[model samples]
Target: MAGKRVAGGGGREEDGSKVGLPAMDLALAFPQATPASIFPHSVSDYYQFDDLLTTEERSIRKKVRSIMEKEIAPIMAEYWEKAEFPFNAIPKLASLGVAGGTIKGYGCPGLSITASAITMAEIARVDASCSTFILVHSSLAMVTIALCGSEAQKQNCLPSLSQLCTVGCWALTEPNYGSDASSLRTTATKVPGGWHIDGQKRWIGNSTFADVLVVLARNADTKQLNGFIVRKGAPGLKATKIENKIGLRMVQNGDIVFNKVFVPEEDRLPGVNSFQDISKVLAISRIMVAWQPIGISMGVFDMCHRYLKERKQFGVPLAAFQLNQEKLVRMLGNIQSMLLVGWRLCKLYESGKMTPGHASLGKAWTSRTAREVVSLGRELLGGNGILADFLVAKAFCDLEPIYSYEGTYDINSLVTGREITGVASFKPAALARARL
Candidate 1:
C-alpha cells in the first residue's frame, strides 16, 4: 500500500512488516466496515449532553439550536465576510425566550446554569459572534440587573431585554483600563437633577447599535465606581463603530464617548456604589467567558475530525496515520476535560458556592486550552489553515480575545494562586510591603 510513513512511539509489527512502514496489513482483520458518518447534520450528536437536562431545559435547547442552525448559520459567513452584525436575527432570537435564560421574573426563563451553558455552546458552535452577543446581553447585562439592580430597574430593563426589544452593553473597560478595570478614569459628577458622566469606553461589545448601555464610572466626590443605565442617543453619548477587527468581524465592537452625558437618578444602579459591586458582576461574567472557549475548542475539534477523514495524502486518508490519530485524541481529551470543568463550575454557580477564584480558574484553564486546540487544528490543516475558507483560521483569530478578555491568562493564574496560597501576589516584589 502507498502511504506516507508517520513516525511516532514504539513500533508494532503487522503482516511481517516492521513499525513505521509506509503501510501494513493486519494479520487479524475483523472485516472491512463502512465508514461512519463524520458529523451529524442536525448537531444533536454533537451535544449529547442534552440528556442531562430537565425536560424544559431540553426543549429550550432544541428550540435555540433550531433557530441557530436555520437562522444564524446560513447568514453567518456572509456577515463574517462583511464584518458586520446581523441585527435582523434579533427578532427571531428574541422570540425564542433565551436572552435571560437563568434569571427569574420580568419575563426571564429562570432556567438552570446547565441550560445556560448548553445554550451558549449551541449558539457558538454555529457562530461565535452570535454567541457573544447573547452572552453579553444575557449574562453581563441581565445578570448585572439580577445581581445588582434595584427592583424598579429590573422590572423596567429585564422585560425589554428578555423580549430583545432593547439591547444592552456593559461598559467597564475604559480607553486606558483593560486589565486594570478598577482603575478606570471615567468620572461621574452629581448635578442638581442628575449625574454627569464624562469619559471614553473602548472595545464595548453591542454598543454600536445597543438601545441602552450599562456604564461604569468613578464618582468625582466619593471616588467610588458606580453603574448607570445610559439610554441610546442620550445627550453627549457618542458611539463610534470600531472597524477592521481580525477576529469576530461579525460582531460590532464600538468605542463609546460619554461627554457630560446626563443620566437621571433613577437610571443609576442603586445597588452599585463601589468596586465590590462591580466585582460581583465580573465574577459571574468571567465564568460565562469560560464556556466560550470550550465551545470554540469543540468547533475546532469537529472541523479537524472531518478534514482528517476527508483529506488524503500519499493516496491514503490523513486519519489513517497514527500521528494524526494521536493529535485528534489529545485534542478530544483536552476538550472533554475543559467541558467537565465548565459543567462543574456551572453547578457551583447554581449552588451559590462559586467564588471569584473559581471563575478565574475556569476562564484561565479553558481559554488557554482553547488557544492550544485551535493552534493545533490550524497546523493540522497545513497551508490551507491560513485560508478563510477553512474556518480554522477564523477560530485561530477568535481565540486570541478569549485568552485575553475577562482577564488574561497570567492575571487569572495569579488570582487563583493567591486564593490557594492565602497571599496576595498582584504587584511586583519590590512594591510589596511587609506586614507589621
Candidate 2:
C-alpha cells in the first residue's frame, strides 16, 4: 500500500505539524578528529612537572584526572552548550575527596596547600567551569569560614560543606564595587537578635544554588567590613542566575539581593571586622586561582596536540607543518613556565614568605601567559577552533573570564607594581582638585 501523505515532515499528515530534526553527532559531522567527549590523553607535561609534586599530590592528581576525563569530559560540551550545570555529577565530584581544600578538620581532607593547589589544577585541566565551581565552594567559601568563623560556626558548617553534602558561596563583590571591593556599600545593621544585611551582590559563583552563603557587608555602626553566614531560603534572600555568559558557562554565577536578611549573632564571622582580615583569605585564593589557568593551558595544549595529529591539510597531518610545530612548542613552553610559577607560589605560601605582591604577580603572569597558550591552540585548530565540541574554542572563551576575575590583570599588575615601587597607582592623580 502507498504511504499516507505527510504534512511538512515524515509519515502521515497530522495537524500540518513539522517534525523536529535529530541533532547531528559531532563525530559524524567532523570525522577527521575526535572531540573532547573522548578526551585526549595528557601530553603537555614535557618538563616532568609531576616529579615536583609529592606522592600524595601525584595520587590526587591522577584520581582527579581520571574522573574528570571519564565523567566530566563526556558531558562538558553538552552542558556548556546548554549553559547549565550538570547537577547529576555532584556525587562523582564529591568522590574526588578534595573539597574544603587546605582546611584541617571538620570532615575536611586536610590536604597540603600544594596538594590542594594541584587538585585545583587537575580539575581545571578537564573543565574550567567545574574547577571554578569547586573553587568558589572550597577555596573561597569554606576557607573563609575555616579562617574567620567562630569554632562553633566551623563545627556547624564545615563537615557538610567538605563532603559536598552542602555547597557554599562567598559574596564580596557588589554591583558597584568589584576591584574596589573594600569600598563595598552593603550594610549590616545591628538588630535585636542578630544582624540585618541589605545589599546586592553580582557575579557570585555558586550563589544561585549554594546551601550556605558567606556575605560581606559594611557594619552600620563600625563602618568596617563584616561577614555573616546567610542560609539558603532565608527571608529576603534572592539569587538569580546570570545568563548569556560567553565563558565558564557551567558555573551558575548569580546576582544576589539581600533585603534585611536576618543572620543570627552566632552566624556572624568575628574575624572579618575589617577588609584586611579577608585579604588574607584572598591571597591564598589568588594562588589557587593562578593554578586554574595553568590547568586550562594544559588541557588546551593536550587537545591541540591530539587534533594536529588526527587532522590533515593538503594530504599531510597538521602537525607536519613547521608553523604548527612552532605553535605547539610555544604552548608547551608557556605551560612549563606557568607550572613552575604556580608551584613556587604554593611553596612560598607554605613557608609564610609569600607577600601580596608575590601572589598577585603569580596570578597575573600565569593568567596572561595562559591567554597566549589558549590563543595558539585556537589558531592551530583553524575552523575547528571555534567549535566547542573540539575543546579549544571553549578554552579560548573560558580563559577570558579567568583573566579578569580574582582581580583583573591590570589590578593585579598594579598590586605588584605598588609593592615594588612603593607607590599606589590604583587611582589616577586625583586631578589635583581642579585648582579652583
Candidate 3:
C-alpha cells in the first residue's frame, strides 16, 4: 500500500499520523488525554468476562447497573450515613425479576447462575448494603425455600418473595454460633402439629423488617437440624435491630430472638434435615459473595479511575504518573482474576459439578484479593477514600463483615483444606482446667 498525501501538506499513511507534525506530541496522548467523560464507569471486565455471559445475562447486568447508577447511587451515601435501609427501593428491585434467579418455579425468573452473579456484582459495585439485601433475600432465604421447601410451601411463599412484596432473611448466625453452625444452639421442639423454636440469631440481615425469616434449629428429639419459616412479628419472634456497626451499616443487621416462636409443620422445609443441607445453599451463596467483592472493588476502581483523571498534581493528571498507573493495573488484575474465578464457579454450578470447596475457595480468594484492591483504592484516593461520599471508604469498611461472613478467611481455607486432604481439621478444643 502507498502512503496518501495529507489534505493540506505532507503525505499521510493509514495510521493517521500527521506527517509534518512530529511524533513528539505522542507523549501528550497519555491515558486521560482521551477525556474523562468517555471513560466507561463501574466496569472492569478486563479479560473479556462479558464474552462468557449470554446475551440475556449481559442484558441483566446492564439493566441492574443502570438501576444502580440511576437510582441507588444518588441517595446511598445518605442511607449509609444514617445507617438506614432504603425501604422504598423494594418494589423497583423486585420488579427486576431476579429474586429466584436460579430457581425455575413459583414466579421466579430462573435466570442462569452467571446472570444472578452478574446482577449481584453490579448492585454491589454501587451499594453493598443493597446487594446484600438482595442476596440475602434471593440467594440465601429464597434459595433455601426454593431448594428445600415442599411444593405447597414453595407455592405459598416464593411468589410474593419474588415480587418483592415480602422480604426474607436467612437466620443461621447466632451470638455464639457464627462459625460453628453445625452445632447451632437453637432448639426446635415438636408439638402436636407445630414446632417451638427458642434461639437468638446475630447479624441477621433484613431481620428488622423481614417478612419471613429462614431459621435453622436443632430438633429437640432427633438432634438433627431443621429449617423453619418464622414470619415477621410472630408472637414470640423479636427482631432487635443491631446498631453502631462499622461496616455494612445500611444493611439493618439485627439480633433476632426466637422466644418460643411456633412454626407450623406446614411452614417447615421438608428437605432441610441436616447442617449439610444448609451447606448446599451456602455452597452457591459463597460464590455469589465472591462475585460481590468484584463489584465493590470495581466501584472503587471506577472512583480511582475518575479521581486520577480529574485530580491533578504537579501540573499533570495523577493517573499520568507511572506509579499511579501501575497501581491501577494491579487493581485491575486482581479484579480480573476475581471475575474469572466467579465466572468459572458459575460454570461449574451450571454443569452440576460445583462442590462446596470450589465456592469456599473462590469466596475466600476473591474476598482476600478484593480487600487489597479496595485498600489500594483508598490509598489512591488519598483523603477522599475515607469519606463515605466517595464509596471507597464505605466499601473498605463493608468488606470487614463480608470478609468474615459465610465463612471467615481461615474457615473457608479450612473448608477447602478438608476437601483437598480428605480430613476434618475441626476438633474440640481442650479445656484448660486447673487442678487446685
Candidate 4:
C-alpha cells in the first residue's frame, strides 16, 4: 500500500511510520529578525556613558567597536561553533592598535589605563573569546614582560608582541592549583646556562600556539616564585589543546607540560622574585577582566533590545509585552550600574589607590550583576535564547567563565571582605579550633 501524504507533504506509510522531510532553514522557518551576523547598534548606553570618556578614549572605543563589528562579529559564531581560533582575524584585531595596551614604547600604543579598559570592554562587547585571547596576550603576557622583564628581554619581545605579529600566553594556573595558583608546583631549577623548568600548567589561554609563554614556577632552591620567558617549541615543552569547553570556544586553552624545558638566564624575569610581584601584574589585569563582564552585558542588552523590537508574537512586537519590557529595563539597569563600577575601578587604578580588594570587588560584582543581565537576555529571546547565532546564548555561556576566572565571585567577595573587616576567611578556621 502507498503512503498517505501528511498536511505539510511529509508522508505516513501503511505501517503508520512517518517519512521525514528535509529540515527547513532557520531563516526560512522564522523569516523575522536576523542573527548576530549583521551585528546590532549600540542602544545599551542608556545613561550617556560616552560623556564619561575622554576624547582619546572615545576615539579608541569607536575604532574598536567599528572594527569588531565589521570584522570579528561576522566570524564569531562560525569560529565559536568550531571551537577553534580564527587565525585569519589576527590582522583585523591587531589593526585596532589596542594591543600592548597601556605599555609605552617598544612600538606599543601606551594608551591610558582607561583607554585600555575601554578597549577591553569594546572587544568583549562583541566576543568574549577575543577579549580573553587579548587579555592573556597583551594584559598578562606582554604586561609581565614590560613590568618585570629585563630591558633586553623587553626590547626583544615587546615590539612583535605589541603588533600581534607574535602571540603570547601567560601560564600560571596548574591542573591542581587554579584559585590556589600561588602554590603551583612547577619548578625552575638552576642549570649551567639557565634554568630547567619542570611541571604542568592547565587552563592557559593561547598556550597551544603562542610564540611566547610567560611561565611562572617555584625556585627549586628558595621556593620563591619565579617567572620565565619560555619560547614556543622548547625541547620537552608540550601544549595539548583542551577540548569540550562550554564557553570561550574561540580561545585555544591548553594543558601544557614542561619536561625539563630550559629557559636561559636572559629570559628569566628578574623582577618576579616572589608571588607579591605577580600580584602587581594581577592587580592591573584583574581590572581589565572586570571590564569584560561590562562589555558582555552591554552586548547581551543590545542583542535583547533589537530582538524584542524585531521578533514578534500575537501580532505585536515582543517589546510590547509588559513582562519583556520589565526584563529589558532590568538588564539595562544592570549595565548602567556595571559601567559606573568598572569606570570607578579604572579611576582608582589611575590614582594609584586601587587595591586587590578594589579590583576584586569590581570584577566580582560586575560579573555577578552581568549574570543577571545575560540571563534576562536569554529569557527575553525565548527559544532563540538557546541558539548561539542569536548572541544572547553565546554571551550567556561566555559570562560563566569570566565570572569564575581572574578570581571566582565568591573568592573575590572574600578578598573584599578581608580588606574591609581586617580578617581573612580564605582558609577554614575549623581546623585551628579543633586543635585548640
lDDT of each model, Cα atoms only? 0.80, 0.94, 0.85, 0.94
Candidate 2: tens digits of C-alpha lDDT, residues 158-205: 999998999999999998999988999999999999999998999999
lDDT measured at residue 17 in model 1 versus the true structure, 0 to 100: 52
Q: Residue 289 of candidate 3: its Cα lDDT?
A: 92
- The reply for model 1, stretches above 4 Å from the true place, is 1-51, 433-436
Q: Candidate 3 on 1-436: residue-level lDDT in tens?
A: 3655445544565567655555443225343322211223865777888887789999998898877777778778778889999888777687667888788978898898889998999888888898899989999999999889999989989999999999999999888887887888999999989999998889889999999899999999999999999888789888878989998988988998888888898999999999889888987688789888988988888888887887788998898999889999999999989888889999998899988889889999989999899989889878767877667889899988889998998899988999999987765344323322
Candidate 1 versus the native: TM-score? 0.86
Off-target runs (Cα >4 Å) in candidate 3 are 1-40, 428-436
Q: Pick the winner on TM-score between candidates 1 and 3.
A: 3
Estimate the overall C-alpha local distance difference test score of candidate 2: 0.94
* Per-residue lDDT over 336-375 for candidate 4, one digit per residue giving the tens place of the 0 to 100 score: 9999999999999999999999999999999999999999
lDDT of 4 at 80: 96
Which portions of model 4 miss their true places by more than 4 Å?
Answer: 1-26, 432-436
lDDT per residue for candidate 1 within 3-45, as digits (tens), equals 5353455464333456554534222231221111122143213
TM-score for each prediction?
A: 0.86, 0.95, 0.88, 0.94
**Model 3 pairs in collision:** none
**Which residue pairs in model 4 clash with each other?**
none
Weakest lDDT window of 10 consecutive positions for candidate 3: 31-40
